[model samples]
Target: MPVNDTFGDVRITTHRDNDDLLSAGLGLRGLAGTATRFVQPASPTPEELRRRAIQSSWKGIADLGPRGGFGSVYGSIPHVPGREFTSFAYLPGARASHRVLLQVPDEFDHERRCLVVTASSGSRGIYGSIAVAGGWGLPRGCAVAYTDKAGGAGYFDPADRTGVQLDGTRVRAGSAPLEFEPQGLAADAGIAVKHAHSGDNPEADWGRHVLQAARFGLAMLDRAFPHEAPFTAQNTTIIATGLSNGGGAVLRAAGDDKDGMLAAVVAMEPNIHVRGGRSFYDYATEAALWLPAALSARQFDDVPFARVGAASPPAWMLRGAALRAHGRLTSLMPGAQAEEALAMLRAGGWTDEVLATAASSTSLDLWRAVAVAYASAYLKRDAAHMPGGFSYRLQHAAGVAGPIDAIVRAAWWADGSGVPPGTGISLDGGTDLSLDPTLPGVLTLRDLQTGHGADADQLRAAVDATAAELPREGLPILIVHGAQDGLIPVAFSSQPYVKWLRDAGRTPVFWKVPYAQHFDAFLAFADFGDRHAPLLPFGYAALDRAWAHVAQGRALPEDAAVRETRPRGAGPLTAATLSLPPN
Candidate 1:
């Protein structure tokens, strides 16, 4: 037999067998039937109806799992007497503590339907709160989710009207474990040989190390939050997302779990590769100066640097030698010189194979090859280190020693010619950053290009390959780019992506902001700081349009005002400035 329960404008049907409550349904059909009979008959006040709706929505959430046990223990407000439970734990490494509180509503007699709130505190902790608010124009049922300072004080509710406040708390347990490990690689072999070398070792190449770390971390989460029956049932949908490196890991996790365990994935600035693989040796040679002490020690002593160099010398071996010599001769130091060599690698035309060979190549052969390559490429005349007509000053500046210096050289080389320094490009803030989105992709690309770990062309092909795998249904895509992007050339990065979408017949809308760099637009539009400035207005306008297009399934109207660029040297205005007193 089924029993009908009504809360505000929404209604639910529940059944009980002996001491166990069977199920509670909160779909539109169920609510409509109950509303017509009970809610309409009562003709209740708007406030009363709102409260009912709030309660009803909670009832649904509480009853989401099997046996309705999830709701049974935590349902209702003011909670059931003697039915409260609190737990505390610490997060490892983070040195934080976390607390969870559960309370059930009093009006509902069923023990299964309850409200649960968990709070965490720490220097920087992740925490969220959920509440049900009912009444006035509110739907029959509504649930709002919020975070105190979780992801920096933002509201995350399906229902836009509700506001939620979250606070930070530490997890008593130590850091969750998620790491990746390579299998089949020698202890000191570079990743290039790792096609045959994949195994767990601290000396493993960077790619393998990162992969291991990610896997280990995920394992830790699984251990802490074991997939119990109730949890699994309640969590029918799991969304994995993050920013930069974290985002890439989340995407990797999603891709690995095709078993519907992860319902969706969001990756911001996914750093997955689209070109040739890079090697550890290549990376080290390119940015030798900035190479961490640990990495250098491992490269020099443990990894048989000489052998690796002989096997895979970079194209610019001569520059590497000159810089290496300059570092040893001048008080620049080995580490410093290594850093300089890295910068020179970024001027483009350098490939991953060249780097790996240089790292493993013999010193004599390596230097000789480098000298020859330099003469051919830069001097355009074969004259060893002293190419005639090439001034020593120019050579030093462009070569191993000069005004360009180590720091400048390293940054330029690392970014590559395709992504030069000061190339103004900003990432969209709509994607979550907590997950470390950029690193994984960057690391992966580096591995492909330098280590020969993966072919660059194959990696690039993966992008289109993955996109093709998505459901054929039309996807509303939002393309955001800055006209003056310096880090990622707008013409190369964003334009190509947009063209691909159009080719696939997907609806792609492009937004180009003037005078905005990668970091500026990211911070401004993402609402990272005070929201009352010039950025807030334009940011919110763009945000509103994006949300409407993505979440609400609506078309954005063209803004003629947006087309007019501000005149040169014209300072932007903000709401705060507008409210200022007369000078």
Candidate 2:
């Protein structure tokens, strides 16, 4: 058997005029429009699912609004007719399967063969990094490969025993190889997510998954054009790129590439941890415990989604007071309690900019969702039986349990975010066993973090496996990050990682963009767009510089610098808005 035989049941689909690889045929115009809709919400065709998935994934990762400069200055709707090959790659004897997709555009330059491999940014679907990697690779006639890193919108409903297949269709759990199936789900359990319930600690193997995707991409290229015979890393140029978790994945791949499989790497806003850096689960759980209360601080009153005119979220203030009453926070005075909570976070390594951007995440209630899911993964517990009564259930509306929504079930592979509180699945914090309505569940996670028992030991071990190390010596590397990113602050991630690299005698290009934050999708909000610049354009510019240095031996900027960015205030974006640094 061939080495790439691990990529099983390869299914190839050719896309052309009506449905090209880049935009799923939506074109630049359709991509800029509202959300893509299915004719039959309950039973969308495979093609419909692909198109919708592309559009949603693109919009989720890139800023495509009128003033974001997606199609105008930097991006396009190129007709890169190509064949897409999909398959499942797995570890030895592991039941969980990671989705690997390879797209070979018809314009691929065989003589100067190039390939770009990426992992999904978050728990999003396989197309999560399409806007980041695909936007740059396809136009340059490079074959692009993507992997979900075993964390995607693959939802398995224990109630119905159904899950999504590789073809973006539903199938009974046993009918085929679903992406994930909880080992021991209860009879009354609702939905089992792949990333949280797989019991695989998928993040531990993200680097391996990216490497596997690269091998699979090269193997598929060999099959796509047999006349070219063999395609190996030695004969081709392979560049790894991704943002957020995907960025972390590519960095891990570069570190683990002892076989010379990768030539260069560019990671944007990566969620990485070094020896002294903070872990994502640690900060995410901490935020879940205190960010709600921190939002009540008077300083954040003007932040987007933090308050409406003179009124802040009363519930948030209540939660903050509850923390003080529980002795988790200081200051008995209600007005001073919130400010104290903010101080506590700052002492724990949280930056001021991160706290400001967190208001939007708090408004969305994303911290709790992340806390519950990560707790389940780190504790190696089943999501159906999470501690402190945390579980996911199908909800028709807030506080109303119901059967799975037909449309949500049908669109799981495309629209789902691989976490609850999305795609119709809502997180239940176990009836709030305390006076604080929301304190008990989060406190349980905080306790697990502070505990020294086997539970904490296991959690620490799992997180340790996700730590990033210096890449193989002399690999061209570039990192671009938004200074205002709250989710993965540069102080704790890129800053320390870059420092570690330099200490180890490696020079990596690092660009910190001012007035830019994570979640380009949030730019749809006028207030957010007005105050912050999008990171995608800077990401593209970094890719251009990295590619030139990697392929043409161009010298990259040796010193790290903070980029000058001007926020578009109630007006259209212009080149001056980005202030992209010269290469």
Candidate 3:
């Protein structure tokens, strides 16, 4: 009888002695048995072996039967002697639950191992798969039995030792509740207390809830891959990254564990600090004084005296001032020089009809007056108890105002130049202040300014800290900045961060998309112009290359292209403008 080699390299030669054949069969069966022991075993048949071989690409089994019918017959047999199987389990904890599973291969190699886990599951039925391929080919007697703990959900302090579960396949334990309190001026001025959700307490304790959820997820991972444990080295590297609120949390986690736990981090648009103090007040004061004068000057033809003694500025004027202070007023002010500002505005489509409405002198004057009003309201509601009745006062006293002002002024100048153009008033369409109409009308400009400042600071700190830990030689860091971002000026945030990283011997790439605002840039990959079109894809491609370098443990290219060669999208002002100068 002809013998065949079916299960990989395992050679099966027909033997004359029945005892020898039985012993060989027993040895193969033992190997399969060891692999399936981790999970509930499913009785295997000849048909199953054929299916397993096809799935795993084990050539040894293919030699046993006919082409198409081989798998059917192989799957029908009760025992395959040398095959593998897998299964999983879900365990619940005091605060959360977890899912654990087993992964086995036909032949066990010391270096090759398997751990099955649920990657994704939803309304669809459950499915199981291995995290890593190949079974650790261990010599028959040297294999160690997998052990771990199971689940339960509750606040288990890392320091406390209660309600802990440990088993051969999984482990579970509780952790301390997460702590969250408002930071910056919001916390310092005691506003958080007055605004507290309910009861006598002014602050909400939602951190505990979030912590419980995260811990539960961790527990699930623990149960699924019981063989793996949290990295224990004192100097082992830990990297954390996230977007928006999650980004802020990741940065906080890294900072909190800075000493030894977290080694690196990547947080995008984190919200860490609050904007409070004299700087804010100063901007309000400037807006109040400057806006009226600016608006009066803009109405050289109509509404000449509108800014002289207006009862109340128009809503559009207030929006304009707020936008200007936030480094988003490029549309209102244009031209290379102040002399050309009016002409540039007119050329961009600001008509006399638009000016004749005179709801509040000129848009500039209206903006200033509105700024003052909003500031006054904010002082009353959120900063009444502060030293100067405003957080901006302290900031001015501390000498930080100069630097901050310089940054804002530079951004404003850029906005006017059409360099980083912003959306502005038009001949036909009214101003489109990107505020949601459903929100309370009582929301003052001061609140918007304060929130925007706080969020910007947080993002800056997070990015800076994260960049500090990254290896100078790794992948290139791509920075995307919206030219017309009102909440966070691209020049102040992304530009400065990139400069700092490069100065520190790191490869940093930057792309400034025109006309694109903060939220819009994230929503789509746009082409600005022929010269700057591929900007978005360039960033993504660079990121991919960086990841490739990371996998190879090599540094990213320093001289790689950092600027785009095609137009990506319209700049902020470009999008707002109806007419364009001929090339």
Candidate 4:
């Protein structure tokens, strides 16, 4: 089979015996270990990089902690040695390229060929979807395909003249095909991130990238098994699945699958904006503006990461005071102003259940980080051109960045979250030494959302380009989402999309799980684990249902229902903990 015209040179690597495709040779025990270490941190081999990346991505996407029901109940680490094919897919004259990876397990069923196409969740690297899709696909004798969707841990440091190569190695400028290289940058300005600085508005093309990856996966299958010769849609059953942004990407692909390339779609906690639904950036910017002050209320004190009983005024209070001084809040008293802030969020459609887990996002400043990065992408700005002096840099000290370190730069391919504040790199908020650290940057992003100008128009256009429509009629689509997801709340995303599908006379399977929030990885923390159940089990169950419907002709549930889930409070998770519905 000939390689697709859109793909660059394909790179093949074989794994066998001790090494496997799913875990990068790290078995079940290694995956549950405390940390992922490279034998040589300074100069890690390509094999070591792959291992660490697989480990890091698994940790980032799943709940492997003792209380999360990972090893004991649903998850497994199989020894499926196989071949991996990686390539960069790009259209002519495009400056940015999306990474496509196909993993064909040695146990792949030549007779019952199945392909699972996935996109990386959030801004994570190419392996981001491993824990979600690979867990089911590979163990079932199926090949799993993944794409970064033009947003991954590919960071380019203009100052050091280094960028991430397709093989997860660092290369000097112009030495290889870097994932992203901004047109205009200075020697000491900052680092360029693919999701933020690519200038390509990659979100608009996420569906295209997934489709291309699927085609690439089919071609690679033919290349790997010539006796099996041609692998076409007719012989292969294809399922598109993903979580978060990756989930949203698969849904978009299903909508664009007019050629009937996809047999079914299973999206988990997807970041989707249907027609008349509130956009992620719009609500995220709003949350970034109000959450800091709102969480300062006395009620949220017991929530994890909420600053209460601190030596001085907590961070929330300090930021709330700043907001009051800036006239963002009305009441003078801190508690009263906090109440006012909470009321505002409530008025804007945020339920108390969804806001309960917001302390984690607030304490980590995730909302601001996400808003800043997305603002740049929506406006098509690069590192050198970001508003309010916002750019990504390596934080050598508190609230400051120095020269890029060699070791950290080398590991970005494995450790980075395409957005900042991960793998040692952070967003430069351009703070004044005496003021609240993140106020200026937060305000800058909020202004872009609220103000009127060409930039706002441009941002609106970019975001509007990502609005997802219902998939083709009668497609077997299954959507599973956490009812209390703090990040991409169910009300803002899945609920409305389900309604849209119903309004259009389409019936898709939707299972909304209670007590399940986004970021199942957060369940590793003590306080967080005790209160919330891991979303992975339900995701796995959804995959099981989708497979049954596609491969075995099992009927899917017609009406949307709320599945009961029990949180692992003050104990380890057992099978009884998750009351999953029968598939």
Q: Candidate 1's error at 197, in angstroms?
A: 18
Q: For residue 275, give model 2's deviation from the true position in Å.
A: 2.2
State model 1's lDDT. Answer: 0.25
Q: RMSD (Cα, Å) of candidate 3? A: 22.9
Supply every candidate's count of residue pairs whose N, Cα or C atoms clash at under 3 angstroms.
Answer: 141, 0, 77, 0
Model 2 Cα lDDT, one tens digit per residue, 102-141: 9999999887899999999988889989999999999999
TM-score to native of every candidate shown = 0.30, 0.96, 0.32, 0.96
Off by over 4 Å in 4: 1-5, 92-94, 308-314, 397-404, 558-563
| RMSD, every candidate, angstroms | 23.2, 2.2, 22.9, 2.3
In terms of lDDT, the poorest run of 10 residues in model 3 is 122-131
Local lDDT at 272 for model 4: 89
Predictions in order: lDDT: 0.25, 0.82, 0.26, 0.83
The TM-score of candidate 1 is 0.30
Q: What is the lDDT of residue 293 in candidate 3?
A: 28
Off by over 4 Å in 1: 1-448, 451-472, 487-492, 521-539, 547-554, 557-563, 567-583
The TM-score of predicted model 4 comes to 0.96
**Tens-digit lDDT string for candidate 1 (488-551):** 3344343554455456674444555443322222222222112211211232233345434533
| C-alpha lDDT of residue 485 in model 3 | 35
Q: In model 3, what lDDT does residue 207 have?
A: 17
